[model samples]
Target: MNADEMARELASLGRRVAALEATARPPAVPAMLDQHLDADTVLYAGLGGWDGQTLAWQVVRGWDEIRSAPADASAGVLAALANPTRVRIATELLRRRLTTAELAQRLDQPSPGQLFHHLKELLAAGVVHQPERGTYAVREQHVIPLLSVLCAVLDLRPSVPWEDS
Candidate 1:
């Protein structure tokens, strides 16, 4: 081929390579806020993910609502989990199903009454459900969301250089 034609062909190939690289690169992270929303006003109403025909939704309310809303909402779940006994109950339930008697014995509670008290709180908060007359287990829908909230709150990653070292 002629020298000029060879140069033109190389330039075309370079342009194609650049275009392919741009397409292959991962998408940039979106900015946290939209033009119309500020930190105080911005809220994620839902996070949806689709796989095949199934769609999973994680719902959240606005920041103001989250701050001011009644305890029966999101706050209730956290409050239910705040106690050591309740946390133990949840962790055990996460592993496998257990009856009230089994849970009480496993936890070494003084009485069934005390275990029932914690269980009631868990039930009201929708963290656990009685599958039948006696068995209790963590609600299936709440497992992932609870873990996500805990992870977000705890945020074990080191924030400072010294901490990392």
Candidate 2:
């Protein structure tokens, strides 16, 4: 083979070796989660806010502890995100901090009062916070947790339509 052809063949062989090495490596077993029957976490690093920072979370709670916790412990947080408008605001905030006017414009919410109303609920629930006077963002520490919750809920799709009783 010519020099160019031989060089291309060598590069392809390197990639195949790398793929084989990756597959040969053992899976990272979440031993703590498996042994304790608890959940792991979601890791996220993104460009967000004016001074962006990586968001990391590793919450591991025993099933019994989770079950025994006060039922209302998360009510405010969940209830705040139950609304369509609030969910939109939250998901947007996850990417970057936004002002009240920006949020309203993006969500097509014409009423400033209405936008504030929803923001208030989110602020109270700890789902979001105002960085300055009016700009809002998902709390830095809560970013991964919030994404985990959204992903888990989104996985609740049914395989087939349910028949009437």
Candidate 3:
């Protein structure tokens, strides 16, 4: 072959090799199917959080184990959110840490005594914590778990609205 023709063929071959190299690279982390198990297990994962902070978690458990879990053990946590006022407090805390006064104001409470009444339930349930002084927030680890509980309840509906929250 002529010299120019040989050069052109070499460039074409190089391009094909580069394309192959790109496709041969390892894939990114998988977002689902954490294991090959098709059934008998469950996985709950979440990403995103209030503010710029991002959060993620993946909890896996055997269906049998989940079924066997004691309801009484978590009944307090569930009970904490049962009240609408407490629910609002928990959701606001998930958004950001807030002092008692800030929370009461944001929540529109005329009585600080009533606000503390609600905060007491959350603190006892371990869903919210006081990081410094009176400021309260949902811990990083609890964010996903809290959301998981809410999502489970929301799923109970036959057709939950797209923007229910």
Candidate 4:
């Protein structure tokens, strides 16, 4: 082959190798909302605010833990979208309250074990809630806030903040 043709062939091979590597590596796992699950966490504390059980209170709670690490907030937000499977599972659970079994069936999988794990992760993230045993629902408080934030980010507005009236 001529030099140009050989170079093109090598480039194509490189692209294929890169694609294979990407598929081989485990996609980065999204961080669970509760990086540090605490008794005071709203997930475990019931939807009620501070006065409920009033369990262990950390010096700085939740997002406050990231005060010094501003970058972590952006990273956390980006990581939240890393797993499509989890997102799909969350969407389904939100739409219809499902037991792990039901979710698995809808997913066309024989067992719901993996779906349950994803649900647990989302639960810790505060994106999903368990109102009763084996029943799961989206936590409107948390989900709405996240959705609003996402909408704000994704919403395409004019480049100029103000328009000529």
Candidate 5:
């Protein structure tokens, strides 16, 4: 096409793009805890992402109202927990806090190196924290939320005996 025709086509394309952007809805923001929540109240938070064609979500909950972290942060946490070793480490921490050496021993690691590697992943994901030198524990704020996500992923439901219905 000639220059004039090409210029007109580009201008039309820009206008269409501007119109689409103006009409498109902004991404949803996750909920936040407002005030001091009661102990019994269960709060669930979720993160969602869309990539043109596919959309995905992950939900987490706690006994008390908890604010949802950003999508990127939540994804990082899930990615860290996706590993078997990291899940075990987090579970061990749930029972009681332990030092790096104790955790390595309990998990039956031949050396602390491998354990530390997994621990580092957990630490970076914010699922586990080191309060002092050599000690580690699941972040208190993440315990219930992590369990909630696990339960949701597992899709736990009431079981019935074959003849009991």
Candidate 6:
């Protein structure tokens, strides 16, 4: 064809190639899934450990191809949230890092001894962390996201709501 027409066609082809490259490139890593799994397993396969007898066969089918279990946090976080005292303790800890006594005082229902008991339970659940002797805080990076998911799953909500005038 004409010289001008050939130049226009070449430019259109270049634009198409650029668009194709953009579509082919992978997007940025999702924040929710990053650091949530082991480096090698992050892109594919779940991070799970189970006893030989305890694990169901169907669950592990195609395990090699499965990647990261679709962002559901560990079971330990859910267990920690089951207890009311533990949940409150986690909330208080999230507000500010605190010593055992500070957490005890903040929890209205539980006595000091009871609060200590709950703290121990939370520690085992991995939903709370002890930075130093007697100091505790919510395990922010991991447990917070787990709690967010749990809240959505259980449909948790405030007990009272303001009246709309």
- TM-score for each predicted model, relative to the true structure: 0.53, 0.66, 0.73, 0.42, 0.52, 0.47
Between prediction 2 and prediction 4, the one with superior lDDT is: 2
Per-residue lDDT tens digits for candidate 4, residues 48-154, read 22212212211224545444457865565446544776666665754557776677777766556766777766766566788889877765445444444445555
C-alpha lDDT score of every prediction, in listed order: 0.72, 0.76, 0.84, 0.58, 0.72, 0.61
**Candidates ranked by TM-score:** 3, 2, 1, 5, 6, 4
Q: Lowest-scoring 10 consecutive residues by lDDT in candidate 2?
A: 41-50
lDDT of 6 by residue, 89-162 (tens): 87676566888877767777456777777888788877788989989975445443444455565555544545
Clashes of each: 0, 0, 0, 0, 0, 2
Residue-level lDDT tens digits of model 2 in 1-165: 999999999999999999998766434322333434325433323222323543334566666666677878588888998998999999999778899888988999988989999999999988998889979987777887787788777777455548432
| Per-residue lDDT over 1-165 for candidate 5, one digit per residue giving the tens place of the 0 to 100 score | 999999999999999998898656334443346546556566565433322222223343463324554678768988998888888898888777899878988899887778889998998988889889899986555665666677676664346446556
Which run of 10 residues does model 6 get worst, by summed lDDT?
51-60
- Best prediction by lDDT: 3
Instruction: Indicate the TM-score of model 1.
Output: 0.53
Tens digit of lDDT per residue, candidate 1, span 72-129? 6767888998898998898888666799888988899998888999999999989899
Error in Å for residue 76 of model 3: 0.9
List clashing residue pairs in candidate 2: none
Model 1: how far residue 149 lies from native, Å = 3.0
Indicate which candidate wins on TM-score.
3
Model 5 segments beyond 4 Å from truth? 1-70, 156-165
lDDT of 4 at 62: 52
The per-prediction CA RMSD against the true structure, in angstroms, equals 9.0, 6.9, 6.6, 21.6, 17.7, 13.0
How big is the positional error of residue 32 in model 2, measured in Å on the Cα after superposition? Answer: 9.0
Pick out the ten consecutive residues of candidate 4 with the lowest summed lDDT.
44-53
* Weakest lDDT window of 10 consecutive positions for candidate 3: 25-34
